[model samples]
Target: MARDPYRLIGRIQQVAHSLRKKSDHLLIDSAGVTTAQAGILSVIAGDPGCSQRDIARRLRLGESAVVAAIGRLRGAGLVERRVSDQDPRAVALFLTARGRETIGRAQETYGVLNGLVLDALGVGGRARFAELLDALDSAVASFPDRPDEAGPPGPD
Candidate 1:
């Protein structure tokens, strides 16, 4: 069968959008947080003193995007920022009592979505999908360094 990259890309986009909408409904309703906020909070829950840079790296998000998310989360009273005693210039993130409770409310979304993936893909397929995703990540990471192939499309 001929491979169509666009099909794969579109499928990924659709699945991501669907998952976001479903999770957003439950999370925003219960915790007053979106999936993005829950994700940032999860990182903080796992690593209490992590910096925004750490969250950005872990989430594969740009630093500026993480900063904005953090700002919103801070404003919502869901997260706290403290000047790191170890590094005066760096700010560390920690979840507040409210943040912890909020994440607790949203944790079910992760488990439910993960279970859906497992059921849809099966264990073997899940492993293969992980390998495929890692390969794609490597390809994308080096793509900018590679020379363009045939340049941009021209009039047919």
Candidate 2:
């Protein structure tokens, strides 16, 4: 019989909460960015000039939610938008210098949180978990489409 995949899915939410809590604690004491903002910045940092639609797709976020995030980031001078050269109708997003600095700090906080999670798992456990996750990911990719996401998760 197949194991309950929902348990793994449910555990992921718990892990997300733990990471968010740790990120919040670090930001309050060491930095000044929220975890959600950090995630947005991280995605922007990786793919500069990506559209808000791309970000929403990458993050599995709603369009309105991504727009709100972009607004906050723009207000903070952490992100900037430019009209696409090829298509005047589209806007591309990039991180400002301040945004890069924030992302740097966020990376540190992320490293700490990652260390906590991986350390708890140990090296062997981490390897096995990664292998299982990869296999599951491959299995899911065989499907025609992931109706839940805007598009397939892609090579994340």
Candidate 3:
């Protein structure tokens, strides 16, 4: 039997989208925070003094998108920005008390969602699935940034 790789990839994307949509609903309803904001808060919580650029790179998001999310999070009193001690020109991000609480809730929501996914994969498949995902991520990370530059020769 022949395998259709595109169909498999589409299924993966659909599952990811569904998971994000459901988790976003739960997060917004319970913690009053969007998934994007929760994600930024998580990154800040993990790296207390991380810069917006670092967040953008880690999240694979555009600088402008990160900036807008940070603005909304700051306006909502969930995050705070301060001048970096080492780099005066750069800004460091930190979570507020409210942000901490929200992140805790977000973690719980993620835990539940992860459990569902893991269950679907079963105990034996879970580890292998995780390894496959990590491998795929690593491979994708090595690709050229611009689609136009993605031709056979190599990145310009």
Candidate 4:
């Protein structure tokens, strides 16, 4: 009998959860940065001068949550905000020197975890996993935008 797709998906998600937990623990142990902080830093590193709104959208997080996270990062001297050149009313975000160094360390920690995960998959399995992950991502991206798309789903 064929396996249920939903069951398989649930198993995959459980595996992901386990891996993420381990990764978060490793980050805290090695870099002293929380997973959430590291993720925000990575996003800022990729898109310097991004608006808080854009950051929230990309991370699928609440605008207020993003703001709070940014505030924390700013307080830590890891991020800076300035008025957007294109929109005077909008604030743009970027990493400070300290933030850049922290992000670099975070990336190294992530790289190690990634390498371990990939190695555990072996060559063929890794390639297939990447292909499937990409296909799923593309499929989700192609879906039509919903009314609540501007913000993340409401809290359950």
Give the number of the best model, judged by TM-score: 3
Candidate with top lDDT is 3
As a TM-score, model 2 comes out at 0.75
lDDT of 1 by residue, 1-156 (tens): 886876987888888899889989877888789888899999999999899999999998899999999999999998999998789998999999999998988897677778988899997899999899899889888778656788888999
Tens digit of lDDT per residue, candidate 2, span 18-89?
877877888656546787778788899999988989888888789899999899889999999999776899
Q: How close is candidate 3 to the true structure, as a TM-score?
A: 0.87
* Clashes by residue pair, model 4: none
Across residues 1-156, which tens digit of lDDT does each residue of candidate 4 receive?
A: 887887976888898889878988988887667788898998999999998888888888899999998999999999999999998998889999999998998999999988998899998899898899999889878888775656777789
- Report lDDT (CA) for all predictions: 0.89, 0.85, 0.90, 0.88
Error of 4 at 102 (Å): 0.4
List the candidates' TM-scores in order.
0.82, 0.75, 0.87, 0.80
1 or 3, which is superior by lDDT?
A: 3
Question: Lowest summed lDDT over 10 consecutive residues: which window, candidate 4?
Answer: 145-154
Candidates' RMSD to native: 3.2, 7.7, 4.0, 6.3
The C-alpha stretches of model 1 lying farther than 4 A from their native spots are: 1-6, 145-156
How do the candidates rank by TM-score, highest first? 3, 1, 4, 2
Name the candidate, 1 or 2, with the larger lDDT value: 1
lDDT of 1: 0.89
> Number of clashing pairs, model 2?
0
In the range 1-156, model 3's lDDT, one tens digit per residue, is 886886987888998898889988988987888788888899999999899999999998899999999999999999999999899998999999998998999898888878888999999999999999999899888987777755578567
